[model samples]
Target: MKRIVAGGFFLLSGVLLYLGVHLAAAMYLPHITGWSTPPGKYGTALRETGGYAANLFSILLMIGGSLILLIELYFPHAAATYKKALAERNREYEKKHNLRE
Candidate 1:
């Protein structure tokens, strides 16, 4: 129960973090990387403007965290069900073909 709730919270936090990072990136990436000049160089612009590589890294981090949390909570049952179904299908196929394993 606690794990399930924690998973839900992690998912929600990830979504919110992604949204915030997306908004910040949309607002600043153009300014940082839009032109060819010293100030517009990626490193210089990010350093001056207090910007980080938020768009790509934040999204990846959020997705990884959320999936880790949620999958840990839910994937065991799903995996077991899938394994059971596959085993049953293999058994049926073997029976039909008079094959033994």
Candidate 2:
């Protein structure tokens, strides 16, 4: 449906946004670090010219975004699984509270 497509687009947009940020960072992250300098500060951003931080940031952001998008894609099923687990724990809690095996 339209809603599903819209949601898919949103997830895709996140991926594209991450890539764009990474690409832009690759192009100019050095300037920001240079401006922020004492001399050895922003260590990770220094050695390889900020590529490390940019790549690391990109990877972490990508992973987190992908995980969120994946969960969003499976939202109803994800919610069901969570609810099932919670209900099981609740049942255990109630049984323990009642001192019933």
- Top-lDDT candidate index: 1
Off by over 4 Å in 2: 30-101
Best by TM-score: 1
**In model 1, which runs have C-alpha deviations exceeding 4 angstroms?**
30-61, 68-101
lDDT of 2 at 48: 40
Model 1, poorest ten-residue lDDT window? 42-51
Per-residue lDDT over 17-37 for candidate 2, one digit per residue giving the tens place of the 0 to 100 score = 657655655565455544434
TM-score of each: 0.42, 0.35
Output candidate 2 Cα RMSD: 8.6
Residue 8 Cα positional deviation in candidate 1, in Å, after optimal superposition? 1.5
> How displaced is residue 65 in candidate 2, in Å?
8.9
Candidate 2 clash figure, as a count: 0
